[model samples]
Target: MYKYDNYDQQMVDARVSEFRDQVARRIAGTLTEDQFKPLRLKNGLYLQLHAYMLRVAIPYGTLSGAQMRLLGDIADKYDRGYGHFTTRQNIQYNWIKLADTPDILADLAKVEMHAIQTSGNCIRNISSDQFAGAAADEIVDPRPYAELLRQWSSFHPEFDYLPRKFKIAVIASETDRAAMKLHDIGIRLRHDDAGAIVADFYVGGGMGRTPMIAPLIGDGIAIDHMVTYTEAALRVYNRHGRRDNKYKARIKILVHEIGADSYRSQVEAEFAHLQTLELEPPAAELARIQAMFVPPAFDTTAPDSVDRSDPDFAVWLDNNVHAHKQPGYALVTISLKPIGGIPGDASADQIRLMADLAQKHSFDELRVTHAQNIVLPHVKKADLYALWQMLEANGLGTPNLDLITDIIACPGLDYCSLANARSIPLAQKISQRFADQGRQQDLGELKLKISGCINACGHHHAGHIGVLGVDRKGVENYQLSLGGSEGADTSLGQITGPGFSEDGIVDAIEKATEVYLVKRENGERFVDTYRRVGMAPFKEAIYG
Candidate 1:
C-alpha cells in the first residue's frame, strides 16, 4: 500500500475542514438542497432514497488491517451496522445522516483514506487487479502506475468537471481479473520483445445504457510515457465528449460518433505535442513507488501439510482460493453473498474480525475484489483451516465463491434512488432457488449479476446469466441476458426473448442454466457453451 506523505495528509485535512463548514451551513439552513447537491457530491455524498450515502474510496482496492478497522469503526459509529462493497472496490454506507458526513471523512483521513473522487462527473477511483502484485501471471505490478494516475487526476483543474464520470482500470497479467476492457480507459501492461515493460492502451470502453468494449488505441507505449499518453486521451475526451445530454456524455459515445480511427489520430496529434514536455516521472520516483509494493516474504515449505479433514473447508479451498506467485500461499476470497443474504454487505463486527484475521494469518493487507468479495491475497495454505474457522464464526465463510449462488447484485430500488425495481431480494430468491451445494457445483462457474436499472451498476452486462430490472407500467419486471463475460475474453451479454415478472425471473435463470448443463461439452463453462451454440438452445429451454 502507498503511504500518504505530508502533501497527501495536508490535502485531506483541508478537504475535511472545508466539508465540515459546508455541513454546518447546510444544517443551519443557509444552503438549499439544490445548492448543496454538487458540493456534497464532490465529497462522495449522495442523497439516497431514505438517507444520505457516503462512498469512501479504497484506492486500488488496497487496505491495511488498521485501515479496515477504521472503516469498521465508522460503520458502527456513524451509520448502519454494515457497509456495501461496490463493483469499483469502494464501500458505501447507505444510511448516513447529513450532519455526520464530515466526521466520517475525518475518521477516514485519520487512516489516510477519503471519499475524494469516489463520485461526481470527474475521474473516479482508479482500479487495478485486486491481486496486482501477487498474481502468478503478472509481468509487473500495476499499482505504481495506478498510484501515479491517482495523484495526477485528483483535483485536476482542467478535468475536474468532465462531461461524465470517468473510470480507468489497469491489468498487468494475461488474465483480466479487473474487467479492464469494461472501463473508460483500460491499460494492459505487457513487455515488448526486448523485455521492457510497456502499456497497451484501450479507450472508450464503458457499461451503461450504451455498453461498448473499447478499441485498442496504442501498443508498446514505454512505461515512463503513461502519464503523457493518458493526459492526451483525456484532453481529447474533454474537448469533444458530449456535454448537452447526460445520457450520451461518456467517452464511449464520442468514440462511437467519431470512428475509432479518427479518435486515435486525434489522441496521437495531442500526444505529439506533449512529447516536448517533461511528462515522464524521474526513474527514482518509479523505483520509490515500486519498493512500497514488493511482495512479503513467504515460507518455501509445501502447502499440502495442512489437514484436508474438514470437507466444508476443503470445498471452500478448492472453489474460493486461487494460486499465488509465492510458494505455499493462496489468494483467498471471503464471499459476502451467503445464500439468502444480501450481496456485499458486511456488518461492523464482521469487518473487524476480517481485519484481525488479515493481521494474524496473512500479511497485514487485504483487497476488496471487483466481484463484491473480500480477498486475503497472501494467505499461507497452512493457515486455511484456522482462517476458515474464524471466518465461518464471523459469518464471512461461504463456500459459494464463484458458484451460481454467489450472485452479484446491486443496491437497487431498495436503496438507490435511480433503481426501477428491487435487486437484493431478487438475488436472495435466486440464491435460494439454487441453494443445494451439489446443484451449484454441478452448474460450474456460473456468474449471475443483477442490476436495478440500466446504469449497469451491478455489471449485469458481463455476467453469464445477467438479470436486469425495469419498471413496466409502474410494475417491476425483470429481463434476462445470457453468455456475457468480463475476463480475458471480454464480451457483452445478449438479451434473451422478453421480460418476465419478478417471480418469473428466477425460473427463467434456472431454465437457462439447465439448458447449458444438458448441452454443454465435457468440460465447457456456461459461457463457452453459450458461445458455441448461441442463444437458440437457451431461448428454447427458457421460453418453451
Candidate 2:
C-alpha cells in the first residue's frame, strides 16, 4: 500500500476543511440546493432519493488493514451499519447526514483516504487489476503507473471540468480483470521485444446509453511516456467532446462520432506536442512509487500444498481461491454476495473482520475488486483452512466467484433516484433461484450483472448474462442481454427480444442458462456457448 507524504496529507486535509465549510453553509440555508450541487458533487456527495450518499475512493483498489478498519468504523459510526462496495472498487455510504460527512471525511483523511475525484465531471479514481502485485501472469505490477496517473490527474486544472466524467484503468496482464477496455482510457502495460516496458493505449471505451469498447489508439508507447500519452488522449476528448447534451458527452461518444482513425490522428498530434514539453513525472518519482509496490516477503519454506480433505473447504478453494505469484500463497476473494443477500453490502463487523483477517493472515493488505468483492492477496496456502473458517464464520465466505450467485448489481430504485426498478431485490431473487452450490458450479463462470438504469453503474453491459431494469409505462420491467464480456476479448451484450417482469427476468435467466447447458460444447462456459451458438437460441428460450 502507498502511504501519503506531507504534500498528499496537506492536500486532502485542505479539501476536508474546504468541504466542511461548504457543507455548513448548505446546512445553514446560506447555499441553496442548486448552488450546493456542484460543490457537493466535487466532494463525492450525492443527494439521492432518500438521503445523501458519500462515495469514498480506494485508489487502484488497494488499501491497508488500518484503512479498511476505518472504512468499517465510518460505516458503523456515520451512516448505516454497512457499506456497499462498487464496481469501480470504491465504497458508498447511503443515509449520510449533511453535517456528519465532514467528520466522516476527516476520519478518512486520517488514514490517507478521501472522496476527491470519486465523482464529478473529471477524471475519477484510476482503477487497476485487484491482483496487480500478486497476479501470476502480469509482466509487472501496474499500480505504480496507476498511482502516477492518479497523482497527475488529481485537481488537474486542465481537466478539472471535462465535457463529462472520465474513467481510466491500467492493467499489466493479457487477462483484463479490471474491465480496461470498458474505461474512457485503458492502458495495458507489457514488455516489448527489446525487454522494455511499453503501454498499449485503448481510448473511448465506456458503458452508458451508448456503450463502446475502446479501440487501441496507440501501442508500444514507452512506459516513460505513459502520462504524456494519457494527457494527449484526454486533450483530444476535452477539446472535441460534446457539452450540449450530457447523454453524448463521454469520450466514447466523441470517438464513435469521429472515426477511431481520426481520433488516433488527433491524439498523435497532441502526443507529439506533449512530448516536446517533456511533461512526464521524473524517473526517480516513478521509482519511488514502484518501491512502494514491491512484493511482500514470503516464507521460503512455506508448504506448497493445502489439505482439502474437507469437502466444503475443497469447494471454496475451487471457487473462491485464485493462484498467486508467490509460492505457497493464494489469492482469496471474500464474496460480498451471499445467497439471498445484497450483492455488495458488507456489514461493519464483516468489514472489520476482513480487516483483521488481512492483518493476521494476508500481510495486512486488502484489495477491492471490480466485481464488488474483497481480496486477501497473499494468504499462505498452509493457512487456507484457518482463513476460510474465519471468513465463513463472519459471513464473508460465499464460494461463488464468477458463478450466477456472485451477481454484480447496483443499488437501483431502492436507493438511487435515477433507477427505474429495484436491482437489489432482482439480484437477490436471481441468486436465491440458483442458490445451490452444485447448480451454480454446473452453470460455470457466468458473470451476471444488473443495473437500475442505462447509466450502467453496475456494468450490465459487461456481464455474460446482463439485466437492465427499466420503467415500462410506470411498471418496473427488466431486459436481459447475453454474451457480454469484460475480459481481454471484450464485447457488449446483445439484448434479447422483449423486457420481462421481475420474476419473469429470473425465469428468463434460468431459461438462458438452460440453452447454454444444452448447446455447450466440451469445456465451454456460458458465455462461450452463447458466443458459439449466437443469441438466437437464448432469445428463443427466454421469450418463448
Residue 270's lDDT in candidate 1: 94
How far residue 198's Cα lies from its native spot in candidate 2, in Å, is: 1.1
Decoy 1 TM-score against native = 0.98
Model 2 C-alpha lDDT per residue in residues 87-193, reported as the tens digit of each score: 99999999899889999999999999999989889999999999989999999999999999999998888998899999999999989999999999999998999
Best by TM-score: 2
Query: Can you write out model 1's per-residue Cα lDDT over 1-544, one digit (the tens) per residue?
Result: 7988899999999999999999999999999978888788888999999999999999899999999988888999987788989999999999999888998899899999999988988889999899888899999989988988888888888888889999999889999999998899999989899999999999889888999998898777888889899999999999999999999999999998998999999999999998889876777877888888888877777564568888998888888889888878889999998889999999999898989988987789999998999999999888888899988887888899888988888999999999999999999999899999999899889999999999999899999999999999999999999988997888999999889998899898989988888889999999999999999988998899
* Model 1 worst lDDT run, 10 consecutive residues: 297-306
- C-alpha root-mean-square deviation, candidate 2: 1.0
**C-alpha local distance difference test of each model:** 0.90, 0.93
TM-score, one value per model: 0.98, 0.99
Scored against the true structure, residue 243 in model 2 reaches a CA lDDT of 97
